[model samples]
Target: MKKRILVVDDEEGLRLLYKEELEDEGWDVELAASGEESLDKLEKDSIDLVLLDIKMPGMDGVEVLRRVKEKWKDLPVILCTAYPHYKHDFGTWASDAYITKSSDLTELKQTIRDILGKKP
Candidate 1:
């Protein structure tokens, strides 16, 4: 089966862009506009990985990562954000990988493949 990735971002444009880009990579993609929505999707779906944005309005990606790690310890989450500083934050340590946002998505796509490749 194709790997299903849940992308959580507050920005509609980014979410759509990621959906299109990730879909082109041949993986199933799901979108969530907020942390709560992402969490809800997680409960309802079988997601192989998460591509999360860190600067959301309500519950930021860090908190979402925390909750996801707490409940689904084996879930692979990649923290994708414009703010590179968060890569150093201890809160992001639990994530499977972290990639700074870029117009090029090469890094993001590769990271996703790397993480998924390691999973059963």
Candidate 2:
């Protein structure tokens, strides 16, 4: 079965771009505009992985990552952000991987494949 990936980001354009990009690569993509919504989706959907953005309006990605890990220990989350400094924050260590946002998704897609143990 195709893996289900939840793409969480406040920016509508970025969210849509990721959905389209990842979907084209054979992933079943779901979108969440906020941390709260992402948590709700996690409860309702059988999500295989999460591509989470760090900066948001309300509950930030770090808090969301904390809660996600607390509830789903085995769920793989990749911290996708513009700021690479968060990688130094201990809170981000709980995530399976950390990726800085880029126009080219090669690294992002490769990271996802690596975390999911899928062949290139």
Candidate 3:
């Protein structure tokens, strides 16, 4: 079965870009514009992984990460953020991987593969 990835980000362009890029890598991609919307999607979808953004309007990615970990402890979540400072924050420690956003998704893709590879 193809892996399904839920990408939660407020930026429309970044969401579309990630969807396109990840799709090309043969993974199913789902998008959510806000933390609230992502949570709603999570309840309805069978997501194999989540690529989450830190800075958002409401709830933010940190809160979402906490909630996801609480409910689905084994699900792999990669914190993809523009802000590098969040890496030092304790809130981000729960994520399976922490990656800074970039036009080049090589690192992100590799991280996803590495994390997913460990999953049964």
Taking every candidate in turn, the Cα RMSD to the unseen true structure, in Å, is: 0.8, 1.8, 0.7
**On residues 1-113, what C-alpha lDDT tens digit does candidate 2 reach at each position?**
88899999999999999999999989999999999999999999999999999999999999999999999999999999999999899999999999999999999999998
Q: How does each model score on TM-score?
A: 0.97, 0.96, 0.97
Q: Arrange candidates by TM-score, descending.
A: 3, 1, 2
lDDT of every model, 2 decimals: 0.94, 0.94, 0.94
For model 1, how does the per-residue alpha-carbon lDDT over 3-31 read when each residue is reduced to its tens digit? 99999999999999999999999999999
Q: Give the Å shift of residue 41 in candidate 1.
A: 0.4
Error of 1 at 109 (Å): 0.6
Q: Give the higher-TM-score candidate: 1 or 2.
A: 1
Candidate 1: C-alpha lDDT: 0.94
State the weakest 10-residue window (summed lDDT) of model 2: 111-120
As a whole number from 0 to 100, the lDDT of residue 54 in candidate 1 is 93
What is the Cα-based lDDT of residue 4 in candidate 3? 94
